[model samples]
Target: PEDSSRAASVVICMNTDRIRGAPMAEAEPTRTPQVDSRAILEMDRLHVSVDGATIVQDVSFSLRPGERLALVGESGSGKTVTALSIMRLFDAAGMETRGEIRFEGKNVLTMGMPAIRALRGARVGMIFQEPMTALNPLKTIGAQIAEVLVRHEGLGGEALRRRVRELLEQVRLPEPLRVMRAMPHQLSGGQRQRAMIAMAIACNPTLLIADEPTTALDAGLRKTIMDLLVDLQQRLGMSLLLITHDLPVVRRYADRVLVMREGRIVESGRTDEIFARPGDGYTRTLLEARQVDSMVDAVDESAEERLSCRDLGVTVGKRRWIGRDTLTEIIRGIDLSLHAGQTVGVVGESGSGKTTLALALLRLMDGARGEIRLDGMRVDGLPEKRFRRYRRDLQVVFQDPFGALSPRMNIAQIVGEGLDVHEPGLSRGETRERIRAALTEVGLDPSVMSRYPHEFSGGQRQRIAIARALILKPKVLILDEPTSALDAAVQLQVLRLLRDLQQSHGLTYLLITHDLAVVRALAHRVLVMLDGEVIESGSTGTLLEQPTHDYTRQLIDSALMT
Candidate 1:
């Protein structure tokens, strides 16, 4: 009976592996070809489906050793899905993968569970797009990287710790030992991303798959990460599979490009060839979107100030057990003025206090010391209850549409919540009319009002967020990284929409973003922020073309490179 029970357990395990489409035995040893083959990875007629819905269809590609390949597409375009499929990282029960994913002559689809596990970190490493979500918050950086080394390389004790420090150093992280002890949240965005890269390459994988690796980073940091990737790839003699929507990145780094759209590869060719002479209309459109048109016209300096701030400063404190609260000032005393019918861009890298200034101007943050005037009315010193009257005229669109919009609420409820609070006297019919108008203005269909935020795409969700802000008919609208999360094409569309809206309604904008391209597209006047101070301020044309400050020059140069 005991023997039968053991046999039954073995059979169940085998069945589970088969259900996952994983091989029951270890992968066979590679058989050397007659001639030296250059292909390190190949995908032939690959298709992936999740819960009966196709996410990737008939994708085929190959990566030669030490070559860089870019997979370009918009959101929900199967770029990430295809990459994940190659890694076999999907849920086995819900995901169905077909066709071949050959890695060094071994078919990953038919590799045994142990073989796949062995290949993942040691031979094929993946750096996910968002480091914050990918890194385990509970673990220190050392522990995270150590686990990879211990599992794949069998390094332990002092040897494991030394390897962790070396990995951190390889990624160019400062104070490797201190960084090893620090938590993910304690590190900056760029630092966290470097840590992620360190973990991905802990075992010195032969192939690295970086998905939107520089998406959340600043322009300077973006260039740094890109350089690091190229450096590491060349140093390790590894092939790179880069999945991103940044066209400039594709041009600069990728040797070849595959343009995917709606789960299918629309075009594939050499990076230079495709860019120089795109075969598909969609590819051409994407390229055209990269050429930003100046959405801002001549600024009327004589116009009245719609929003003005003087000596604005914001500070916060961290409580400690043994001493007084540790105070940290985010924004220093800074003055800002936005003229009516104008867009004033406040650009900076991460932690440069652009968002802090916006929050202070909106009176959303506590411990803000400043004098704020909106249309010549003193609103900063007013109490919360008294400030209610000015709320309708002052609104904001946040950075992350996914985070900004309430998941539980439908589109109508989310957009109409501001109206319910600010204009309670309006009837239900009037509220519906206003919501419809707002949705239409943002280029979203009013029929989607009953749908939840998750049902919509990233671009659509952003439009919904814009509608929520615009429904209030605010004179001064604060846009904080409004189009940063969107793809290049969607970003251009949103910029165009904002321009049209501003022209029609004479809306004053306080645009806060790290994207200089966005500033060039929509902002009339630009203010470059560094360490909470306005380092440079001028018209977008002059500031971007011939930046006077050293820091401003660096920012512009980095942006142009990307």
Candidate 2:
């Protein structure tokens, strides 16, 4: 590497691509004779760094031919770094890697430029997490795939077109011709993912690198795409290196597992053995991630919610504040507006005022000075007695359902707690009926009303919490990391339920979380907070893809598992 500030232990392995000046294109690789290699891909004592910061350290593993190996960890656990190192792509991002990465008896770290470039697409194909970004916006799907074939296999004209159609068909997409002509955004998420797979496997690479392939898809589509990948891997006789944080996916598909933490390999074993009896503490915690089922009642679509605020600031002290007093301004200068059925996501690191802002808006915290209006009615600074009525119009669903739901209270009492305060004169029979209706509205069995919160799973308890909020027919819900405590599949189920409820009931949402995926899934607008201040705010797509603030960019990049 030429840069003095950033160095890579690259071992000078490269054969110049025409693009050294242009972006390097994967060259037509000289296919070696098929041999029974011990390992399709192998790495030893690998280390990756960027700007003098260590990300991946001493990671070693081997992926056997036709076997599925899962590299498991949360974001920033160095999963992507290791995967990218295998393809030798760190140079593009100004990152450095020092270690031996061998592919089929050849150390890629020692291979020449052309040799490494050939390995990128011709020998080891990569499927990135998001296809919308991976696929060209201006190019047709057919043209993109053809470009790959032309660069590697040198196909032309009718054959190139024919191969593109064949790839679409191979991925089991309906009407190859239609998909071939369609632009990326024109296709659904699942269809776009399938196209990505077609492009990755075009040259029949010996090893396939799938980096968070299904993170963007819904619960059902995740399974379908994985199933397709497994089938293709088997039929094509290719090894798969799956990089993901999903424990359930690893259990369902991966044969071997490599657990990473803080850039180091903490554990490695067969998938069944690791799940059945994990050795590492972090590995066990990941295995113990909650799993639960959910249900909801059908409601007629009716939308009506409006929330806005200005000059809002919440101080951590008594209700009164003075310049000399010991008061701290935790949240300041917040301006927000939400229309009916709108979802605004509040994202930041812990203690960054996300939760404090929610409390200020809900009027749950004291020392909050701001102009707050709900549905065009000023509610700020109202007396306790007067504001109690507005409590029925606003509600909150917390991050941990187990912590929020009262274990001592039965489901009926929990859901009907508000009804008792607001409609104290209602008959017992009427109260019970309303509670039942509320539980049914949130997809919970009304029959379970007699059970306590501890009797339910994580997902069920969250639904109970939602039912508790819905019992009052609130116009707005403050969802504080509502789905973070659930498993990946359960997370999607809850997100889908939230979207449906918002559309049908015309309810508004203020979502607070650190997950960008969740933000993209639910939020129409996003506010990036830092040090109790709003540093950047914009529409979901623009801000996430092209952030203007340095901290906001760092936040997104960290979440991106770089």
Candidate 3:
């Protein structure tokens, strides 16, 4: 068998209708399969390096007409870089690249700018990770989408307008005419994504590469986007290269799975086979991480609250950076309470004022107004002089560990900064002991106390942030999107850790998040906000399961079906 010169993998016959993973259960045996006679794309033993650091080595994968392949891995694992290489999207001058990319059996590495340019946006189309960044800010959605058609196919005038509107309707954006007139900034995150997808598929390219296309979307939006992609793929018979960290999408949609780590394809197999028993350690870890939800501690509603916010409001003078003339009310008047040993979940879409509310609670935002009670003492509107005394009673855990921690400071100093601030008379040795204990509580090795934030993974860096907060032994802990950045399994782990810590220390928590699944898993009571307004408030079971408000129902429906 080894001596035979056949390719090891399945031979993808290039037929537009003969897509990979076609279901045969409902088909008649007499019906012949159709194959598109084209090789959409291929990567051969490619090597890539970033800033002298090798990222991908000898990575090879292929796509035929009407095939679907998923490239999956953790952040910084090179899944994106590989896709960039395929598109010839990355600049070739500074970064080093070696290997062959065969498109229609022609080596792309040997091609000139003219030949490569002819392929991009015409023969090859790409959907970016962040639609907010992908769509143009200055152009209306219709104009922006039309540009792709104009540049690639020379469609103009009334034809282009009609095509653009049709494209919007295909992506299921309501009121296509009205949405077309709006700019990217005016559209919701999901709407902008739909527009971007419309632009990508405008040219009807043979290949479509999607890079983390649903990261910013809620559950409902994610589902809609995924379904749209699947429907488009089937209808157009386009070969799809999906790059994402989302496991559920991969299992439900992908035909083949390509596992990447440190820029190499460590495992490639049928989707079900790879998911059932991953061949590589990295693949197994990635799968395991996705399978689990956020780590969480069971909330004890019976426990008392250590801290709470009563009728909180924060206002700040608006800057002229975005053409705003007057002051902006970020957090509207709101009343919320946190019981000791209980977790309260705050949820909303992007820019829904959730983070603003958290910042207000910490009094971090300038010109704050509200009543923040820590251990029964009013903290809001307290003078800086008086606020310093209560700082130890409340602490916050940030979403990004890399930005939150000081680059120059070691873990010991980062964790002990709270102690040094509140208890200055303590000796250096005492601080070191406290830091070590804090690291242990967060399940990190005490040896890491000397390392900087860069010396950790996303999950580890987040744990360090938690450790820093826990070291303060603050009565109230504000967690802001703590697990959103993590993969599913790592998120599950972190959630469980927070719950355990909350129960063991009898800590009160105010969690702000956009993930409803997480809210369902972690929150006892749920608060829904939109446009600086608290539109829905009730227990998690009541609000999420049977919402009275239309807005709340839409939110819940979007999250569930997406």
Candidate 4:
């Protein structure tokens, strides 16, 4: 495992032996008792290693029947690995696991291949982190869900189709019949996640392992998914093992909380007690980091406008064999302006056209129509050759840093590519100096420039992405969900870095994200979007505190609840 010191200070490691031997004390009377019922799953001194490197070390935890147990930690903390080990999902050739994993009085480690296969869906089901990758894109949603039922229960034909539709309805999916025929890509993020949940619960497994189930979902959708999971678990009388970095969700949904650091349990107790008075410093830091403060400074209204858009719209569709092709408008008529040194946050749920608007503003989308002005120059209608001059002035940091970055390129090549394209006159030595400066600005070591993206952590990769965007010294930077992939502590660090950079360089930012807390932290103004339209816009404090639009109010309430 990578050194724990590389992680955020909020995820400090504690003594592993003490955590393994100690018993959870009684929590405050205000909180629910920690697992008084019968235990359905028990992991005692579990140790997992990959290629002879220890990832999970002497970890121990238990899940009571019908109870919610949360395994909370940052990335590389062995939360996912421990959960995957329960189902023997890791490659046996390269991975080694020791210690006891008991489910219903049966040892899982000694189970044969046939027994493991029978146990996976029928007794223990899992909902992976990324539903898009988990669900087969080529297969219909009904066929995917029915596969589990047919394999485990031997139901086929009409009975299989009927059960699949029933499962979709149980998960509260709309248009069950249509959803049954729809492919994974045809559904929205929340709908795809719901379908994955339906598949996991298709067999009515005694235990369900949800790995960051709501990681990429917006506040409203996240709340809905959490509620659905709780309702289903209660109705079906199954144990829930939730692995996530979201502390608020753990506090609200989990009965018992286990805080992990460097593959060891640092703290374990009732959720309320853990949040109320954490025993470890790491836990306290994690709790404190969740509280975000406003960082918007006083704005100069008379400052020069860095970017402006008029009647911006984007429509996309596919060709059909018969009749005219259907087009769905992604971004509606949007009129907005951003002044130099100001940060404007566009907040919305998935498919709200936030990303579409960002792409349209940057002229990256093919079907975008409308006026896009940068630095008092209209470049929206410019041809590709003519638009090259404006590309350096406008840069974008995408949501997924890993996806946005080239896997084959090293940090120096990735960050310096902008300079090579925009400033061809600059010498190689000059380009290297600029890359080093940008890396230092984003809190990353310049020595790692030779390393590929896979060598760095998620937070580091995001920093590298920022370095790449900043290397151009753009007048307008479009940040799309820049910090959503990080843990709370790392997110706080990134937000602070952005605020500092904005103040130091007078950088203008178009922040597009579903995270209201991030918007609250850095945005001077906020625009609420719903169904491809900007429903509300105002100062961050005014809009978030007293939102007039019902959709905006719903978003805020859901965020606060989580």
Q: List TM-score per model, in order.
A: 0.80, 0.51, 0.67, 0.83
Clashes of each: 0, 10, 26, 0
- TM-score-based ranking: 4, 1, 3, 2
Taken over the whole model, the C-alpha lDDT of each candidate is: 0.79, 0.74, 0.73, 0.80
Task: Write the residue-wise lDDT of candidate 3 on 1-562 in tens digits.
Answer: 1111111100111222232222212221111123754566879899988678787899988887777889987766777778877756665445889999998888887888777766663567677755654555678988877766665557789977877787787666777997898887655555676777777656566778887767655665566677767766766677889998778778777888998877778899888899898878888787665443434455566566566676666565555777865565766778887776777888877657787788877877775676777777777767888899787778899755555788799888888888888889989898888889989988899998878885566678889999988887888888887876566656777888887887788788788887887777777788888877788898877888798888888887666543
RMSD of each: 8.6, 19.8, 9.2, 8.0
Tens digit of per-residue lDDT, candidate 4, span 228-297: 6776566556688999888888887888899999899999998879999899999998888999999888
List candidate 1 segments past 4 Å from native. Answer: 1-38, 49-54, 90-97, 104-122, 131-204, 318-325, 383-389, 406-410, 423-433, 450-455
For residues 1-562, write the lDDT of model 1, one tens digit per residue: 1121111111110001111111222222121122424688999999988688888899998888888889997877888778876767654458888899999999999988777766664577777765665677788988877776665557788977877787677666777987898887656556777788777655556788888787656787776667766765665466889998888878877878999998899999988899999999999988888888787888689998999989999887667889788677878878989999999999888768887788888898878998999999999989999998898899999876766788899999999999999899999999999999999999988999899986666789889999999998999999988887678988888999999999999999999888888898999999999988998999889998989999999888878877
The candidate scoring highest on TM-score is: 4
Q: Over all chains combined, what TM-score does candidate 2 have?
A: 0.51
Off by over 4 Å in 4: 1-38, 49-53, 90-96, 110-114, 132-199, 318-325, 406-413, 416-434, 450-456
Worst 10 residues of 1 by lDDT: 7-16
Residue-level error in angstroms, candidate 4, position 312: 1.3
Worst 10 residues of 4 by lDDT: 6-15
lDDT over C-alpha atoms for residue 399 of model 1: 72
Clashing pairs in 1: none
Of 1 and 2, the candidate ahead on TM-score is: 1
